[model samples]
Target chain A: MFPLSPILSPKGQGGGLRILTHVLALSPLAVLAWDFARGDLGANPIREVQFRTGKYTLVLLVLTLSCTPLSMLPGLKWVARFRRSLGLYAFAYAGLHFLNFIGLDYGFNLRLLREDIFEKRYAFVGLAAFLSLLPLAVTSGSGWARRLGKKREQLHRLIYLAAILTIVHFAWQDKAKTVEPLVYGGVVAGLLLVRVVGWVRRAARGTGSQTSSKEP
Target chain B: MDKIRSSEITPEHIYLGRRQFLVGAGALTASLVFLGGCRRLSELAPTPEADFCGSATAGATSDELGDPLSACDAATHYNNFYEFSLEKDDVAELARGFKTSPWTVQVGGLVNKPKTFDVDDLRRNFPPEERVYRMRCVEAWSVVVPWLGFPLAKLLKEVEPTSKAKYVRFESLHDPKQMPGQKDRSFQWPYIEGLRLDEAMHDLTLLATGMYGKPMPPQNGAPIRLVVPWKYGFKNIKSIVKIDLVEEMPTSLWTAFAPQEYGFYANVNPDVSHPRWSQSSERRLGERARRETIPFNGYAEKVARLYEGMDLRTSY
Candidate 1:
């Protein structure tokens, strides 16, 4: 039901829908902060914070992946402008989740922190997913676009890798409940399938064509 | 048809009975039922069915230390009962239709006297008492529950364990019509759990029939379930229908489902982190601060000796 044209107008990239997406993207944290302020994070606030932030990161990662496919849809090209906000919010949440685990949970016990990051497969993968997103998040700007030119597109493609790692991280982390993770995995798989199918179509068209459409 | 009422608090005993445990402590449980009798069992708020014994004289503890009780609402709402659904809230909603009556447990395998005991038989044989215990999950969340049941050791002793019985395997009820999540094959049907013979014999391991004093809601594994405090919550297999004493160490639902991730003895050793996450600390349910996880969930003095020579990191 959201009207996308006004927010993603040609000249005004940061329009109504962009602002709305930013608000929606970051609202879970606001609710969480409210939960913290109200002492409503159940028994363990640290775990709650870690869990919510991680979930938001994963969800935003998935949502970010969906933005490109949405752009490909007829009349929905404007949705691409919303992707950068999603990506940044995803990174911010991932940072919060990481900081919560290391700072509050482990209290920066480097040995133990090292053990979680370097040793635990789930932790390692989660950290890897966040690390993969770091460069993409940093370069998600018009300035980076002006400076890097064609290189910006290549660097931003790491978002796809980040998406895959994030799904893997979620799937591996959950113990008994595979339904939610599998659903998320299915969504990521579907998104990747879209990309793969498009790549195959482009390859079939011919290699000599220099106007190969860059994926958003 | 075979449902044990609150009045039938069985006194038959081989070891210390509920009376010996409770009455010996001198004082009775006080009449302080939280928030009043107006509590209603709705989807919004958990009305903890009053503890069967309002004033259980014997105080339950992890070791010598007492576990602060978890809010009943949070415990019932935040269950990992994948048999019904993966979503925590859906557990109660989806499980509302489950029929927990007419349940019978087959005490079989290497036991001296293998017999099928109905729910009533179990209640008639072993009196349930309130035990406030630290219930930890592999997901790194925890709760201190006031469980109503007797030691599993007592039941194993009742049938008289054969010398060959080195392990005790507990199996959950398998009714697809009732448990919808079983339809997905996410976990093997009729969830199974196990303990070393010594672990089963330990007084702390209980066969929980109820929580917060009233009969356990179906969402929390109604009829009956195992409550191994030191072990992860999955080890406390819900709606158990079989207690199989076996010669070999049995493969529990989790261990068989994913041997790489879950171990037979899912002890609470923060040092031995899960492959996916840090187990160094856990968030107690209904509270905010992440607390350091205790070895064997603070029951190391009682159970650590069982694994004196075994390497926990590998086995776990």
Candidate 2:
């Protein structure tokens, strides 16, 4: 609020915002790598890596969802430009989370992996979330968005479904303390609620105008 | 005895920093309680200068399977004591102010001679011995620890169990003021666990007082805790205040909470998987790769006979 030029950059076409988003997104990975290199990953390093990556993915996904709501505000229109980058970063972390699970934890054993997908509920939900995010990530390029047109929006609505699945995956994975995942679920619910209320209002306004025009 | 490498140990500065923080926090809590004109729920006892096992002359061995002992920091800091906290890393800090000194454990209910034994007396009566054990958690993690304590059978023998005693029930302290987790209704307070009389009297069942040549940290269940190597980690109750020899099979907290997931006889059988995940292999702390989990956590040869006729799959 104090100064917009530093963050938004008047003539830079959201260049400052883009730089800020990249810095925010990549810093978690950099810190993780630094911790790994310094042997500070703690007792269960594999578990630690998996936990941090999964948590980062959730955080980025939540932020990506927030941009649309924030863009509706008068001065926050530039936030919409950061959504695609944030989603892609979330996907990257999810990919790393899956890799750590299958490779580091399970040693890339196909039989074990297959069994895990079929038998483990948490694993199944995690896999579903990753698969849903895959298409959105692949189609994030402007060329693909233009080629698909209206269908792209339809396909990208899968983010909502993916976020729910991700939350379920996290809640199911926890052993006893469920407060953390429940808090994430609460935030996602609030964001979805905002979208739902807005849609309802728009629908009601459209119906009123249609009736008024027909009477005239 | 094999010494843990210096590099494996936690740096002295970090360890001392944690100690200083604990002391500072304890002083702050005391001052706040004093100023508020309320009786403190439980005051932190000054740290015991020496370990109860410090006077032990008996020598100890390394891990029975020749595996390296887990670092002292990992064994002490990382815990699953739900009484203090649900988070593994938070337990150490949260349990810092727990009172362990001036404790007593009541042994009664179907015993020929019921007696309330002071913790210090128990330490003196039963000389401490070190036993290196491989502990397997239901969450598919394992650690090898050098625990200092005497066999549970020694204590069980002191107060002879009547013929009616079929199972031994252990109850942890239930002061909600001291244990924050107990305040939550998710789990019934005063965590309870039980073992079959034979299992309780088994040669391998230990009443651990310390680990890593130091007094048991509060997070690891100071004063005393059970160490049943042949079972899942949950079966080893912590900070026990009461022991009762009962006529009927007693229900453990996990068993009561989720009967299907946690059974009364939670013997570690890799072939029998947990409902949520496979227990076929476990990630050993400080190790790069997962290793195949062993039945009875590698103590099968010594304890398998106990479950010779019973179907482990059904029991599990």
Candidate 3:
């Protein structure tokens, strides 16, 4: 008889692995917090901290979304378990990035802040990206998931739109089309294409199932 | 699962993790130490006094006066864009090799006396005076600079401009071997600048030989440069070699490159906007926020009289 065991059973083999994964995922956040506390954020610390946090947030968000495709592989069941924590970390960084911009860049000047958001195209894109991420971040925890019910999946799908806006925010700010933004855009385009293919297959299956049931 | 547990608990794994942590912490510590050192280094570079180079005597005051803080700050910070090793700070280093004593100013065109005046002779002929004025750049930045030199009008008096001389064209030193910018054909060099007869004679306009109570740093247009307040920074040409009284307007470096962007007059005006950015606001050196730029950079009281009954919009 084969050993009758769940691959990721919480009580057995996966418990230590789960703790290690959490530590690895949370380390960046801890380092960033330490950096802020020490005031070792580099010259022009406000800009430096905001840029780094925003960049890392986007990377983590992309990585969280990538878990779904990775988990589809036979040997990669553990990848799905890390997605929730990765997403929470992304939200944490994004919030910090937004707060830094408001406090440092605007100095809480409401009138100037409003003007910047409305008058400047780059600011508008950034604001849009922030707004898109807000709902997703709010709905990330299990409590919110339970309350959202059917709407939970819809809210999470907004991450795709947020990711696109993030890319635009970066690209538009760059006067020259340098390699950094281009690489981000390429990765995002590839990820979006994977979703598109999945959606098409699902739609095709639905149509085929309907025809077979009618014939039977 | 058993194999994975052994791998996780291995001595190599623990050692590697500890080593990585130490390295990361060490790198962070080193950077912090370096930054602290930099702050100390910056402090060591002597701070300028509030009234640096200002007149010490209460009674003796020059007509050309400016805010002293702005003047000293500008004298140090803002500089001519000499892209070569003779950059603003390093000019003293590179300039020691060059011979500035044998320099000559070629006076030709509509001047009655079309002759080469040795720099020493010119210096002796016109006694140098000190003038402090606000210098504003087209890039929407400004500084108050105290210039030590004589008026161009005084120099013009000696040359004796002919009746045909309507415009005064000034050219900068042109040696590709010396000035690397001269090698580029994109800009016509020796950099030429022109001023109308009345404008050149204006009391505010000075041919500066030195700044900050010392001989002009080689980077700050050593020997001589034109200082025209109420005009954009570029109008103040550097390291002049020739002064020609001409009939037509001489081609200016900035204006020639982009006529729409830079006009012949190049007078500082808040109304005239640069294509890329607004000219209405300017970042005064050491100021927190940008301030509204004034017409003729606040020299309208003196310079506006010269442009009486003339359209500034056309000239600008």
- Error at B275, model 3, angstroms: 4.3
| Ranking, DockQ, top scorer first | 2, 1, 3
- Tens digits of per-residue lDDT for model 2, A36-59: 776666567788788888988888
Q: Which candidate wins on lDDT? A: 2
DockQ (Cα-based) per candidate? 0.14, 0.17, 0.07
lDDT of 3 by residue, A156-216 (tens): 7788888888888877654323467778778878877877786677667778565332100
How far is B118's C-alpha from truth in model 2 (Å)? 1.4
Tens-digit lDDT string for candidate 1 (B46-81):
333323234333344342465567667677767788
- Model 2 spans with C-alpha error above 4 angstroms: A1-11, A197-216, B1-61
- For model 2, which pairs clash? none
How much is A206 displaced in model 1, in angstroms?
Answer: 10
- The structural similarity of chain B in model 1 to the true chain B, as TM-score, is 0.80
lDDT of each: 0.75, 0.80, 0.68
Docking class of 1: incorrect
CA deviation > 4 Å runs, candidate 3: A1-216, B1-66, B71-74, B83-99, B180-190, B275-278, B309-314
lDDT of 2 at B151: 92
